[model samples]
Target: MGIAVTAPIILGLTLEHLEVGLALCFGAFWCSPSNVSGSLNHKMKGILLSALLIMVVSFFGGYLHYKTWLILPVLGFLTFGIAFISVYGFRASLISFSGLLALVLSFAHTSQELEIYQYALLIGVGGLWYLLLVVIWHYINPKAQTEEILAETFILTAKFLETRGQLVGQQTNREALQTKLLNLQSELVEHHATLRDILIQSRKSSGISYYKGKRLLVFVQLVEMLETAIANPVNYEKMDVLFKQHPGYINSFQDFIFEMAQQLRFIAEFGNDIKKLPKSKELSICFEKIKEEVGLLKTSEGKADYEDYLMLQNLLEYQEKQFNKIKKIKWLLGNPDMDAKDFIDRNESKRFIVSQDYNPKVLLRNLSFRSNIFKHSLRLAVTVMIGYVVGNFFAFQNPYWILLTIIVIMRPSYGLTKTRSKDRIIGTLIGGAIASGMVLLIQNPYIYGGLGVVSLIIAFSMVQRNYKASAAFITLSVVFIYAIIQPDITAVIQFRIIDTILGAALSFMSMLWLWPAWGFLEIGKNIETSVVANKDFLGKISHFYQHKGKVPTSYKLSRKTAFLETSNLNAAFQRMTQEPKSKQKHLDKIYELVELNHTFLSSLASLSSYIQFHPTTEASERFKMAITKIDDNLSQVITSLNGGKSQNMASTILQGDVFFKEQLAHEKLFLAQEDKHLERHDQEAHLVWEQLRWLYTISGSMLKLTSSIDFD
Candidate 1:
């Protein structure tokens, strides 16, 4: 907003050139969403690179303007190439977007420009102005980004804690609570990515203060502690069974969680300026109450099952340690001089890394019409050309509107395209109505121009956050600007609305009927990938156990990949649900698959958490065999799903061996002995049993999924 208001004044740019500059600003802003607190140097470099690309695209677009026949083919290929390359990553995608927009804008106004290079130069200058404003804003409010990060981290942690509180009750919907927890974990993973960016920026840039770096380090440590707590959250269902006879203890535990959540919210509110840590004795009291309840059970005539007692004891001890960690974190937050440097260990984040073969030969070898991105690019090219030809045939006042609408509204997936189509139409109608009213009543050019700038500022600001609102404001800004230059807006608004609708309908139709990428169609492949990743993760887990629970980087990476792949599978299914009925396939089975995948991961996570705390060298031979069998079954299932030559093991894997159940029962009997004490490996063995049970269920689910599909 500040950039839009002051860039022209600062750079002495004329309003005509400012429009080009504003376009560059808008492109840069859209490209780098959620990066307000990122390093000024990176931000500036990105915009400058985007600006240069735009200049080159614009220059070539202008040079090719006179060749009327080449325009469609050239622009089509340009759009196709740019959109296809977006398969790489966000930064690369944004750079591609800038180039595409440059081509579009240059193609539109090429005939009017006497010197094409000057117009391209003006666009570059405009990008530079926006870059300057962003840099200045970062320097002026250096702590704002760090503060935002802390606030988000704490808020998410609070929400997760709240979910944990809810899950403590037997009456709670475990599936729903589990879903919410998984979502929160995904959000935390996203936060970790953002924090890594901030840390990297701090390391490279002197603009960040030492105090700020130290503070971020402390928050990073706090986040890691929170992660450990959230990730290893007790299987509430198990806790419910343990506490069913003593609801009082559960209530007290809930109270502690509630207080902890409140404490986190307060920290979020204070951020770096916390005067003193919010005091809370509720957790301590709750801990004592739980201990008392457990003691009473031990003294009762109807003695509690020793295995249950051991489980409860382990949980309570974990909670006590977690409580102390939270209090210590609060104390550190309150003391600004605490040595967080020693505790800050930044893990390299791979959350947003999309692996793509950039080598031309490799890309060419892999390239085919079957690629979704390639097909999407082709669809876009055809749609844009159709829009252009249709508009020109109809003698529309602005043929470019039709092309622009197609460029902005089309997506690879039917669901996204359908959504954007609605937003574009609704936003255009509203903006047109408002602009028409203002144009009919007001004749002041200055007022109209100011309103235009204000609308432009708002549009750019909200573009990343809310596309519908941004579209409306962008429409209003464009209309007002047109009104200032060309006063007759009745025809303009009518043309704008009609052109937008036409283009949107075309784009939507294209996405729906032209090489549409239905998630459900590819869900089998997604499931296969997920199963393979989880298999690798299970292998790593097995290796960790074999090596006395040492978590190497490779194990962590495999775990991360498994979780991320599951999340992706979940997302694909979710997107499929929102799509048209025609796009939704194998609905019930897909839902079950997604649920099973989620449960599988959560179950493994529970086991992993316990194994980390208590290294177990005594995992029974049967337990190891169970995991190996599950891994083999997973590979077989993936092969079946992919239509490879594999025999159906549905009946084979569905039937669990008595050995696993016997081993688990034996462990329980040993733990239940009156004089037997709680051993570390005993708890580990129990968790292994629990995880095996989940894997058995997952195997059954895989059988059901494969049965439902007609792979033959």
Candidate 2:
């Protein structure tokens, strides 16, 4: 509290009121931050860094007799350059913007130097008060943050599961869920980075059991599958049986997730109630069931280890209890969704055909952090503005004045840009108006004291509440200072309004004109690629279904092809949603493909997994060669499907058509000519021929669909 109280006074003496406005500008740049929640380590570093920067400016500005206002601009540019790498992109933004604001508002004023004792008391007191509030709030009730994050993760997982359930060949909707799932990687990244912030109790966070990690990994794998299906439509026949069985075996998995969600809400309702803890072994039971099912079905090459399995199971149990405790109330029934088969069922759907010989591993794409060209351009433009302006202003050197600067820059997506811009303008305008009015009233000391107290209350309340509200109070504080001290209201209001409006206008225009956001065309192109790939995947599947004897790998290749296509579609659709509202309707239409793609792929994955697991053990070579041929054809089809614009894909296709195989290769098949004993040939050959004809018909229809969509 003492530190909080003294902070402003020291600031006024050392920076805002510096003899040269230039030195004050540097100090002001350092002073204006809303520094509450940063790591104690980071905050200490910030303090040291700011002091060092100020000292540099003071030496030159004081010796050169440069005004604080003018010299401050130089410090702003210099600080941004020096701190950009160290501070990180967003923090650097704050420092850079603050410096520019000081220069813009430069007025002739000199600050008196503060004694060391006074300086220590002011900053130290103010900071301590804020720190106490933060520490208490965090420690007294800490579970809320963790529960909220868990809820978010669960919901996201549920959405992906929904998408996976619909992938190619088994359902009405293909790739319908792809778009939504693509955003998972970004969210995952954010969650990973701020795990500590999301969960207050470090000990409890570490308690997460092994099963929980595996479950998360499973979810990640599911998303990977969803993305692939979107990129290329998969052939269901080639899919492993597990994919098909999953939809049924794990029916309404999301409902179970939803049950877990109930705890998330309770934190608010009961304030960390103890009774709410999934007081029973329900989560443990759930994990046990999951493990049992995995074992029965032979998941992940029929060899999921007990160690990892049990660990994951324990983690789930732990989360269940923690999740319940967060809400504060107890639920007697727990989850009604828990059922008999959820624990016991092994999918009766078609099984896989594991070969005696080894099979190759499947590799799904991973999340990447590639640099975006457009973002780079935007960053450059913002930096240029910070540099050019600071090259100009300086008056009596006062660094603390930097704290008063108010300018904003932002992107429309995060809600930061609009909120900051509005507050910056409103606070400046209103503050100036009040300042103009205050100078006349400053003659009375009681009135001045009362006003200061009111300002303090507003600052505390606003600081505890929202950023914009806090900024508003800060603006008022600045006005109060000038008005009570100078006793001139009208001129202050006029100039303050002018400066704020200018800053806001400049920011808006710059963001609007430079490297503007892209529109729907790019999104459309991306969707087209996915759709086409899916179509091609369907064609290969058609081929596999028709030709069963020779090429065994046809079905497997088809599923993989589908997975790749699905990936591309999901990514494109995800990108589209972040666009402005005007582009949303079209993007939504395209995003629907994500769900469709997911359904298709899961079915295919199930089939592929099943086949890989349970290969009909007869002659190995004959079947293997046939499978290889089919796989080759599928690879070519996938390549053709993904050919974005103009691709000459003739050479990439199967060398000789199946229809022409007997004719071109001179293979002998027992055939009865139109006059051959009037259909008296052997029944087996006749049956085989009829079956073959039906397969070709189905295959032809699929090919037509696959080749239909042209990306361009």
Candidate 3:
């Protein structure tokens, strides 16, 4: 961005075409946000699309700026059209943002038709220049972004595991820990999505090279580690009950989990330099300590408490599996030439890369009051037009500044828009005050110019990471730039604050009144999707158990979908809480549903994880019945949520109870033996049966919960 902005300035100054240089800078600055991390093809496509849209919007905006009577309709049409493109997905949304920004900024400069064409062309050229620089940088360091995202994923995963460890300790607040886990899960889902796009798209475009393949393998390990962690779904209440009789066991497990987290953090810290990757910690000692505790419990309690002993053993085994996954990741990192085929098939790997639906029909389909994006687009257009009218009516110094604030602050959701509006206002006020003081104390244009450049760099870099800080730097950059060009710096600062507040007010009001799509109204769909994903995940686990072998790509994909949907549901619930209390319908019920859905996913993970690691007996009749009942319950829940009548399935419920009794009787026979030890297969089968029964019960609860919710 610095290069893209500065190079044009230098050329313009050298040629005494300062306006032309600034126009080019505007072009680059508007398009740079879309040049984010992705595969080369995606990066190129996003930037090129953004450049084209910006040029077109700029041309039209400039042509209509002085046509007073036509401003409202043209502005409304362009804003809606550009904003509506977000239906294509995240990358498209960024491009849409760039276009909308260009439309607003275009009104700031007046030009004849010829001058407009020249400015628009120069802006397009500037976008192309930025694109060129990005490509060069990509080639120079293709792996850097992927590595950085992967490193972040490792860190987030560590935090997630650490939180899970906290959940194990007796004195910790489980509610707080659960909330922390949810937040971490949400962050991991986002990072994982980005990493997936980078690694998977790169493989599709450039084919898998050694480094890409290795990174992909490491990513798979990280994902498996997450699933494995999720699979260690310790019933905290039960754990507490057991630990009351056997203290220090919980501490040992907690320490072991923390150790795993520490190992992951180490990997993240030194991931870029494989040679510096630290040696694997001796987790075996921790395992031995825990094992000794479990052995003592078994000896002291005898066969009467063998089930508890098995539970402890299962927990221990889960940790060991987690430890092995970390070890495997470390080995993969150290061994660069490791075969990618061992991880995922080249031909089948494309299934994991989620592609956006770029079909034009998607846009037309979303052009309804029912569509959230459509409502948001319409809201944005009206708000921007209102901002324009209010600015002109008030005769602000730069009416377009109001438009700029509107464009930047407004978002598709109320929570996001409100948060951005507040941050923009607060940051602008502080930034305006600081700039006011700086201009009063300093009189050098050179200082202003340098500071403007520095501020622009920081603002650009921090936009995604810290919006408040970015807004501050953006204010400073704009003020300093105008300070060099305009004499009345005080008015610029004053109007900046006023315009921002006005635009924010317009945005907030528009979101409130213009077909507002409250999160509660839409959260049901999220809940439905999450439940469906969990159902599919359960089916996958059932199939995996029936056919014991390597975890298929389909199973992994289902797991990913389940996790992602649950994360989305959690995010929606969070957004709903942030919305107006009056709009947050069924808040308590929704929270309960969200928690149940999350726990169900964890239960699925536990069942799947156990089957994946341990050797289990044949998929028994009782197990099949349990899985069927759970599947029926989930399907019924989905149906009920979709406004269809849910079948009671009383017969299936009765059969499941009967099967459970038979399985329990069979299990007791093994416990009655003097040896108090069952075959490994018998033990695994019993655990798997228990997991299925547990899932069936949860699914029944979810079904009842769904039926009780007043979705309307």
Candidate 4:
């Protein structure tokens, strides 16, 4: 609003009043969309760029400088360049829009042009105003982005726990939990994107971790298991038995889920009041159950157990590990360390939009998006073309109406198209009716300027508030503008209505003809490509680890590749989910796969980190050799996956304890060979080979696990 006022003022100061009006109208409407999605920095830069570009384009195009319809496309090309820099491909609506806006305004009451110098003066003033308003908005709410991030992150954590909780109980719905987990993972990605932005602005850590992440991942796995069970509910009794057999684990899971929900609620409030949760009663109960249930499974003379009882033992261990991680987090900045502020800086923080991928293609569809690109584009183009022709024919008598028709009709989203079309028609009609009444009721009017201000208010309010209310307000304002402009009331009102109807019809028809391009499909495919790249990186890591001790640059690249891949896929999915009709089975699967892939890779990374910290020694060389050999087999699995080959584990590998013992024998033999070889005065070389072999075997297996998750 300030920009609209100040732009004309600056122009009026530099040139003529008529020139100031054109400059104000052109610049104000040219870059009008509220840029709530972008940051303060982004909005500032984008508005400036948009203001400059529109000034240059509208200036050339406004004075009828081009006889041909080249101006719109040229404007589009410039907008695209701007979008490339700003990263707003879909929301920006480039060339088609430029023509649509300028033509409608020009065709309507003849628009006066600004002098080039006047336009330049207004441009600077308008840009500054835009910058000012955005700054003021931020000043009122500096931590808006941070709060949004924290809220989203907390929501996902609760969701993860809920899904996992169901998996633990006897009467739990497995299929629903699996779907819930996929949804949770999708939320996690969105949270991360938000976190990246907060990190960029305020270096706040989003408390995600190896254990919690893996828990969610494993939840999905359990859901997968449950889904299989759901398909055969006849085995309900058996499933219930499995649940009863692990009461300790089930109780712990419930406690974890409940605790997580409480934590999330706190975080979502964006408050630093960490909960002093009571000591988990689940732990005490679980200990009692373990003594009774598992004790029965163990033989009198040996540490033996029923298979389910053994599973219970493993489950307990997992619970403790999870709790420990949570405890560690509780110890660190659980109170939101204010001192951490001094450590944060703008440039050092990562931004939300920063990623390995950007979707630029206008014709791509998001995941599971059913809308066909070429067909949709063709349909829209034809409709828009029809609008253009119809608009031209009607413009001679009611040029303003003709342009409005086209602009009102060209909606990208079907629902939005419907709403906007109806609103434009109504607003125009109301404006016409108001114009007719005022011209008839009053003798003279100089109210157009005041009405223009009212129209601006209505436009801004309606855009963010309710669509219908906004349209109604705009209609009133437009009618007011027309009545105050001149005394020829009846003819002008009728003319205005006709022009609007024609413009509306042209817009509606053109959309039916020429197809608007999509930006989702290209993004989706690119996301798929990233996933492939991630798998390759993991495979390379596994294979390379088999040959070296220190992680090479190649391994770092692989880790970076994994991060990049997930980010790309997640972003594409986020866009898809934003559209209506996105909740479908295919989308669910894509999301699930994304979750699965992230979990597997993060685990491998975490596992690798663990290995780096803890090294082997001569005192435990025998066990080290055994573990290394086991890890080697995992490496073979990675190679198979990388080459797109089938994985066929020998049954012996699945023999568990027996197989492990046999591998230990091999490790001992290798260690003995190394010891003897080192004694020959080549100790350093032998030690180097030992370290390399350790890295190759252990790291290789971890990488293989990462790849297999993707390959499968």
lDDT of 4 by residue, 1-712 (tens): 6455545645675675655565565555555553444345555555665666655554554454343375445433433333223224433443234334543454333334745556545644554565576678667975575455555565666566556656666654675665555556555655554454434423223243332232232222322222222111123345367677546545655665466455545545633344653334554464455446545654434322354554454445444444444443343324343333343332333322453334545334321124443344344444444444554554555554554555445554444555667777786676666555655665544455565566667666566456555655565665565566555556666666676666665555544444532333333354445545545554554454444467555564555455556656655555455444532224554555455454444444544443433452232444344444445454444454454443444432444335444545655666666533123344333333333343333334333344444422
Candidates ranked by TM-score: 3, 1, 4, 2
Number of the top candidate by lDDT? 3
lDDT by residue for model 1 (262-372), tens: 878887887566664577576677778878766665554454566566666766675666676667767766676765545533444333233345566644643676577
Per-prediction TM-score to the true structure, in the order listed: 0.86, 0.45, 0.95, 0.55
**Best candidate according to TM-score:** 3
- Tell me the RMSD of model 4 versus the true structure: 11.5
lDDT, each prediction = 0.70, 0.40, 0.84, 0.48
Q: Which has the higher lDDT value, candidate number 2 or candidate number 4?
A: 4
* Cα RMSD (angstroms) for every candidate in the order listed: 4.1, 15.0, 2.3, 11.5
For model 2, the local distance difference test gives: 0.40
Worst 10 residues of 2 by lDDT: 360-369
The reply for model 2, stretches above 4 Å from the true place, is 1-109, 114-189, 196-260, 268-273, 276-407, 410-471, 490-494, 514-712
Instruction: Report model 2's TM-score to 2 decimal places.
Output: 0.45
Model 3: runs farther than 4 Å from truth? 111-114, 282-285, 302-308, 336-343, 547-551, 649-674, 679-681
Residue 57, model 1, lDDT = 72
Over 1-712, each residue of candidate 2 has an lDDT whose tens digit, in order, gives: 2233434445655765532322433343343352323333333444444444334333333332355456445544543343332223344344344333333333333235654333323333333344454446546754444444444554554444345434422545443443334555345434432332222223233444232222233223333333333333334443324335454333333333344444333322432344454443543455455546545443343233333333333333333333333222233123323332232112210111111221221101101112222342343345334423432343212322322332343442223444566777776666555644665555664465456556655765664346556555565665665555555546545555555555555555544454444434444445445545544554554344444344454454445445545555555555556556764554443444445444544434433332333332232343333434334443433443455322333332333245435432432344523333233334333332332333233223323333454433
Q: How many backbone collisions does model 4 have? A: 41
Q: In candidate 4, where is summed lDDT lowest over 10 consecutive residues?
A: 225-234
What would the TM-score be for candidate 1 when compared with the true structure?
A: 0.86
